[model samples]
Each structure stands twice: as structure tokens, then as C-alpha cells.
Target chain A: MQESNARVGAPDWLEEIRWNADGLVPAIAQDAVTGDILMMAWMNAESLRLTAEEGQAVYWSRSRGKLWRKGETSGHQQVISEIRLDCDEDVILLKVEQKGGIACHTGRRSCFYRRLEGGQWASVDPVLRNPEAIYGKKQGGSNHE
Target chain B: MQESNARVGAPDWLEEIRWNADGLVPAIAQDAVTGDILMMAWMNAESLRLTAEEGQAVYWSRSRGKLWRKGETSGHQQVISEIRLDCDEDVILLKVEQKGGIACHTGRRSCFYRRLEGGQWASVDPVLRNPEAIYGKKQGGSNHE
Candidate 1:
């Protein structure tokens, strides 16, 4: 099936994205060359369209009720390498180029800021800076800490 | 801000995380040693519960309306070695041990499946296999392709 489909059209696996009851699918971003799982975001049709068309990783913000362009303010945008829909077409694989230091607004390279040590969740590193400082806005910066 | 709060009660950052609009925050996961991003997911109160207790990456599944263990079904569980909460305490960082060959369920090593070639979004590489083949039953496997 994959062989025949890979030849004529998009990969046969593109059909696997499972959109779920909602029109949204979970998208996982990773550093394409390094293979790091950077972050996850939601992608509806519109967000997906913008990401694919403009080659930017666009996401649907559940909190703000709109589309979000990664690094829009902080210059931490994710450059699109590819966008793969899962077998069910519900999830997406966003290969991105996150510029600057951290893709997360909170001043960390990534958003996860907890580590498990001796069975306890512990803070491993300090935040680099406030998102507002870099982004120059309150809500536009997603981090509150 | 960080010093005064550390002397007494909950750090100001921790307080900030508790009050997030959606009662949840973004968490980032990276390879502990290699620093490769494994994946990103959402964490609410309950999602945090499972992640801390289980020592792996857990996420809130909006579609399922429940908590999801990253690799319980797929054997790709992210074993966290360290965690950090940003100053706003809203974002989290996880240094984890990614189980299995790839962290992504879509058969890529990670979720960023597409790469930009020239100016078009392209499938960067062949999927390792149908997710069904590796994860086996229960995850809605799709090795059929």
C-alpha cells in the first residue's frame, strides 16, 4: 500500500492523522537536525494552512481563541521543514527552526522546567529571563513565572 | 523576587503557575544527555499528577478529556531525569530518557516530520514503520500502509 501510494500521491501514511472529535490535532515540534522534541501545540485547519502555506509553525491557541505564530514577538519563530499528518490526520509533526535561544517564552530553552530526582519533581535550572522583557507585551508572552 | 519568596512560603513563581487562566501550562521535554527535544504536550493539574508520580511524560488529552502517558501504549514513554519551572512558574522543562527507537508515534524519531526543501514543505524522511507495527495493538495502530 505504501509503495503504490508513495509513487502516485502523498505518502499512504498521510491518511493516518486521526482528527479526534474536535477538529484539532496535537502537534509535536522537534529540532529537525538534532531530533529534540521541542514543544506541542494544537493545529486546526486554519493553523495548519498557515503553517504549510507560509512555512511557519502556526498553532491554535486554546486560551486566546486565535491562531499563534511561534516566536511572533520574541523572534523565536519555528521555520517549517515539514508538516506530517499522523495516520489518522489528527496530529501533526512540525519540523521547525526555532531561532534565538529558547522557543518557550519563559526564558528557558524549552517549556518543561521540572526534573525528577530521588522520586521528587525538582527544578533543575533557572529561567533565563521574562518573556515580557523579550516580547515586550504581557499576554503575548505566555509565561507568567 | 526569587530570593524573598524562597525564604518563606511558596515561591512567587509557583504561585503564578497556580493561577494560569486555564489552570495549566506548557511543558518542554528534551533529551537529558543529547539535548534533543523529545516532544511537547500540555499539562494541567491532573496531567502533572501522573507525570510526577509515574516518572514519565504525561499530558492532558483535550480530545479524550483525560491524561495520556506518552509511551504507555507505544512504549515510547519519556523518563524524566530533571525538571525546571520558569520564574513565572508557568512553563516547565523536562530532561528525559526517551524509550523506544523514536519518540514520535508517526514513525519519525521525533514529531518534526517535514523539512523545507527549496520552498516547499516536504516529507523529510520515510517513517520508520507503521506505528501499529511498533506499538502493537491498542494505540489505533496503522502499519497497514
Candidate 2:
């Protein structure tokens, strides 16, 4: 499939990416409308391909060493509007419509909630919802931490 | 310095980070005023500490195996306004004012100027300034490619 696509000079999409030595690239998810950055994750070729085909966020979980469909458990899937590659071709930008409004496993709008203030890290953004309510107590506690 | 700070229960800032196996973390630079993501890079503990101390972006270049002060050569320094950490404590975000209004080595405002269109990565953003003008002939051609 890749060979045929490359020959046609078509979207041999994955071929152009400058994957790291581990064959992975960092993917950042941004809100299409608000332009707020939601989260950052890693993706392998397979997951990237699947994301394009599926029109959603799919990442490779390094810890689990497996494919992770965002919001599969929590139902907070991201609907992709656009996929962008950086000038370096080493990173990916996913302009997505975050479904649940809450992108962080901590039930915050974004994962980046702690800001450095007065020589310490402080929670600048409030948690929109409780993790226990979103993922259930059994899984919520350890979901994204 | 680190020992004293830790003992005082003060900003033992770097200790809370979950650096990768290589003792590095992914850092994202975002435009403080416009909220645009300018670039992404890797940072070691020392670089992160220096960034906090200097109020500028300092990244650890994997290819060069050394520290990289943003704009040290190109004069496009990013003055950091805020430092944020993700909920997982893995990723770092810098809200910065990009000097000269250019962040990419390609002389664009952002490194992520390429957008995926019709199965191809297309340059969506124009070159705000010519690289040759910025870095000169010998250095410009190969600066960020």
C-alpha cells in the first residue's frame, strides 16, 4: 500500500514524517474553534493512519505499549478538523473539536492547569468536573496520572 | 542550590517533573498574546531551570547533545511570561512573547506552518521574513531543515 501510494506521488502520508528513533512522533491536540491546546500525546504510524481514517484522535500509549483511542473509556473523543505537520516534519498538530469540553483526565478543560507562580506550581485552571464522575472511581483515580 | 531549595520545601521545581528515560521532557512554546503554539522542543532539567531563571526559552538539542538558547543566533528570543505544567506532570508549556514575530527557523511566525491538505503537507503560512535575510547565506539554507 505504501509503495503504491509513494509511486503515485499521492498521500503516502506517513512516509513524510520524521519519526524519532523509536518510530514515534509527538502529537498536540488543539481546539479548532477556541484554539486552546488540549493535550499532547505520542503516535506511531499505525495510530496516525488510523486517526486519519477514523477522523478522531488515536495515540500510542508508551506506558501500555498499545494503541489508545482518546476518550474510549471516558467518552471524551476528539473530532479532528485538520491535521498539520510542522516545518521540521517531526511533530503533528491535530485541530480538533473536543467532544466533552473536558480534555484532561483530571476533568479540567486542558491538561495544562498548573502554572508556575511565586516560585511554586499552582493550579491556575479549575477542574470542570470530577474525575470520579467522568471515569468512575475505580478507573478515574489512576486514569491519566 | 537544588539541595537547599528542596530542604526548604520551596521551589524544588524540577523534582516534580516526570522526565523521560533520557531525563528530558517535552516543552511547548505558545504565543502569550495570540495564544498560538510557536514551537516544541525537548528540555533537560538544567535547561528548564535556566529557562526559569532567565525568563527565556532554553532547550536541550538532542541532535547537538547540548543546550540551545532560543534566538541566541537568530535574535528571535522568546521572553517567557508564564510556565505551566500538565496534569500528568510530563509536559511543560511556556507562554512567551516571540521577538521579531518569528519563531520558526524557516522565518515563519511558527514552526507549524505546514497544513495537511488533500493528502499532502502544504505550506499554509507565508514566510514572514526570508531565512537568508535572517541567518545569512551560509547559515540560512541549512538552519532548521
Candidate 3:
């Protein structure tokens, strides 16, 4: 009784544990100061554990089938300030401190750069941080057409 | 009549503009398949057009005061397939085809790689791409501490 009571006053993030049929849950990341979303990813028990263990944001790569550590190389680390779970326990909202410019590797501050309009998509923002500057690529090699 | 009809049939993304005090809207990007949120950014009417016009994600960089294009240099491009707007018109959602392994400059598949537990942060994933390969000295100078 004493042991459980000692651990009782924890944050809501610690109690969140609703998993999908595939044993996964959706985790959403946002900028704590700006209220801007930085990115989203999945987490299982182990992946969730890894994120809490490290202050840097971490996620499960569904395609790569591995754990992904944020800022390991790029230096755009997310220092978490808070984590919240929705009522259903299936969704998580992370409030974090971003260390560098542009959360998206695509060179945009955010991943949502395309707009759906008139049955056509459009590019509204100019390309910042020349991809060559960020990725050292010839700017036409691997990105999808 | 032509302009009016053209506007009516246009995709919701274009027809509706979420004008804030500064004539901008908030855009949120989420994983198309996994429903994991990747990041958030801002756009004006013009910025939104650049994303659709280029077929790549773009955003207005408030910090840099420029229109930023995603993946123009980095291989990690987000090909937008669809865009959704909430009822408030102040927020937007982007559905994207992310390639080259990440949405984050930090090399995480998604920018968010941390989870909160018991009032402490946890690491939930591993590093996907080599940050040195993606960012070089720019991101390499940061400290893990």
C-alpha cells in the first residue's frame, strides 16, 4: 500500500496505455511555445519507454522496423516539457522544445508544405536552406517527383 | 460567373483561406498511413500556393522570415497527396507521401521521438539516418547533454 501510494501522484502521460490492434498508438509532437506541431510518429511499449528514458524525442519507424532517435546527427533535438494522452488513451500530444531550425528534413519548418486546392496541389513557400546545404545532395537525386 | 464557379469547384484548400490577424493559417502535418503527426507550420494564401504549385511541401519560416521549401536539397521530401481543413478555417491538415526516410532534420522518421512518462521524458526510438550524412557540421556541433 505504501509503495503504490508513494508512486500515486504522477503525470497523466505515465498512465496512458491504450494500444491499437497492432500494438501501437499515435503520438503527436508539437512546439510547446508556438503551439505548432513538429511531427508525428508511432510508439509501442518499448518505443514509448525509450522516449521517456531520453529527453530527446524518439519514435518507432514502421517501415524501418527500428527505434529512431531524434537529433542524433542533425542536432534538431526535441526537449520535452510535457506529454498528454487523450481520453481514449489512443493518442498522445507531446509538448517539446526544438533546438534547431526546421523540424522537417525536407527543409521546411514543418512537414506540411503542400496545399490542396482546385483539384491541384501547389507549392506556396519557397525552398529554404537549400537542400544541398542541408543534405549535401545534388538537389535532384532521391526526393520523389 | 466564371471566377465564381472556378472558385466553387476548387479544392477546399484553395477556396477556403484561414486568415489570422496577419492573414495566415496554421497547418498541421500528420502521417498519412499511420496517423502520426509529423509537424506544424504556418502559411498565408501565397505560401499555400507555393506548396501546391511545386508539388512539394513548403512553409513560411517565421524565424527566418522567408518561404521555405521542403526537400529541395535533402532527399527527404514530402509529396503531398491531400490537404484538409478544419471547420474553424484557422487550421489545416496535410496528408503527405514522405520519402527518403524522415520528416525531421534530426534523422528521426518523425520529428517527435520522445514520450513522457511519470513526469519524466523517455526515448522511444533510435536514430534512422546518419545525421552527419544529412546535416554535417551544422547539426554535429550540438551536445547530447
Candidate 4:
């Protein structure tokens, strides 16, 4: 999806994105230094633009139906190092320095802490902090929403 | 999202997925051998169920509004080695053996071949085969839609 960078408005690169019918694209957050996939979230055009401009992670919450700035509540922000889009222009990948060394609301290093084994998913990673302590009680279910 | 596997109808784990308003979840396909993310696609409950049962990659095509069987045309099927659900239960990950060594319709090993550089996306991965050779003319845009 590369082209000359002289185009106006949203730039030709952003326009090349094949946004879903809902105007959303899947964005993956990977740890820049460790290359470990921290989490996967959705982003709309506005959130993507904001993320690029803000140099941090911003995602579209499908359930909440709004923009979600990473670390807005839990103090686990992701500092963007680089952003890359897949060849089809349908997926966005971010290389970020995960703050607090935790990416999952469950207090784990990554959202992908479980692995499939023998037709069952087993949690292989330990929770660095308790969710109750990280998000408090009222915000415990914030990540899922 | 794990639970005892005795529930009837859909499993309890599957029910835990907080599907979007459109009843979809973003699924990421990663190369089982290299750990390289090959592509990202959407999956509905049926597609996810089928992928788990069939042990292959199946995705929901938003443009076409139907289930897509990977490598149905290009012989680049992903033989799933493992399936994982993110902690939020909104994202899926598949570890697969990408057949034909090509995951992108553009004949690249992964769809994430472009790297953002200097405000521009530069293709850093070489195409192993030509798109014309992989899918012929009629199926050239099969991967996109």
C-alpha cells in the first residue's frame, strides 16, 4: 500500500486501509523490545490517527462504542515505537514499549497468557498483579467491555 | 474463559467471548514454526467452532459476508497447531503451519511485509511467488475480499 506521501486529507496510505463495514480494523500491540504480542484490539480511523499523533496506544472499544486510550485507568500505557500495517491494509501492528511490564488487565504480562494444550487452554503465565488491586473493584471488568 | 467441558450446545468457553455487535471476533494467524504473524481475519462463532473442529484456518469475510476457508484457491492453507483466546475473550490467535510457505495473496510469507519508515510504508519482505502465478487472474483479489 505504499505511495508518494504528497497526497492531502488523510494521506493516501490511510485511505488504502480496507476498513471493515463497521469502519474498524484489527490492531495488534507487540512489545517492541521483547517482540511478545501484548494484546489485540480494534481501532477506527480516528483512533488510529490519534495514536499516531499521540505516540501511544489508542483503541476502539466495540462494546463501549468509543475510543479507549491505553492506560487511561490502570497506569499500563504503551509507548509506541513503530506502527506497521499488513500487506492487505486490513491489519495494523504496533511495536510499543509496554509500561509497567504488564499488558493484560488480568495483571499478566500479555493478554495471551494461555496456550492450547491437548484440546484445552491452559494458563502458562503468572499474574504479575491482582486485577482487583490494579483496577480496583468497580473497574475490575473494564477491560472486557 | 476455561470451564469444565460438559456444557451442552456451545461450550461455556465459547460463550464467554464478548463478540462485537456484529457477532465477530478478530483472529490473528501466526506461523507456528517462526512465530511470525501471517495475517489477521474475522471469525464468527460458527467459523471459530469450525476452525477448532476442522483444525484449519477459517475466517469470516466482511466484504462477502460469508465464511472463507483459507487456501481454498491458492493451496496456501494454514494447518492449525493451536488456538488461543485472549484474556478479554475478544481476540483469537491461531498457530498454524502455513502451507506453500506463503500466507499473503501477494505471495509473501506474511501479510505484514511492510514496515513503517519515515512516515512511509516500505516493503521489506520479498515476494516468494508472483500473485498471478499463485491465484491466476480471476482470483487475484481473492484475499482482499
Highest lDDT scorer: 2
Best by TM-score: 2
RMSD of 4: 5.3
lDDT of 4 by residue, A8-126 (tens): 36755677777877787789998888767889988887788778889999988877888899998889999999888997788899989999999899999989877766556689899
Q: What is the C-alpha lDDT profile of model 1 across B1-145, one tens digit per residue?
A: 1223232454333444542455556666667888755455567765665576677888766456566778766777788776666444555667788887577777776554454444344666567767778776567533111
Instruction: Give the lowest summed-lDDT range of ten residues in model 3 chain B.
Output: B1-10
DockQ for each numbered candidate = 0.22, 0.67, 0.09, 0.48
lDDT of 2 by residue, B33-68 (tens): 988988899888888888998999998877777788
Candidate 2: clashing pairs of residues: none
Interface RMSD of each: 6.6, 1.7, 12.2, 2.1
Candidate 1 per-residue C-alpha lDDT over A35-73 given as tens digits, one digit per residue, 9 for 90 to 100:
655566676666666686788888877667777888776
- For model 3, state the Cα shift of residue A135 in Å: 51
Please provide TM-scores, in order, for all candidate models, with all chains considered together. Answer: 0.57, 0.90, 0.48, 0.84
Candidate 3 per-residue C-alpha lDDT over A32-127 given as tens digits, one digit per residue, 9 for 90 to 100: 787655555666656665666676677666555666676554566778777755433456677789777566666666544555557644655445
Which candidate would rank higher by DockQ, 2 or 4? 2
lDDT of 2 by residue, A26-75 (tens): 99998989878888988878878888889999988877777889999889
Q: What value of lDDT does candidate 2 attain over all alpha carbons?
A: 0.83
lDDT (0 to 1) per candidate: 0.61, 0.83, 0.60, 0.81
Fill in the DockQ of model 3: 0.09
Error of 1 at B107 (Å): 7.8
Best by DockQ: 2
| Candidate structures ordered by DockQ, highest first | 2, 4, 1, 3
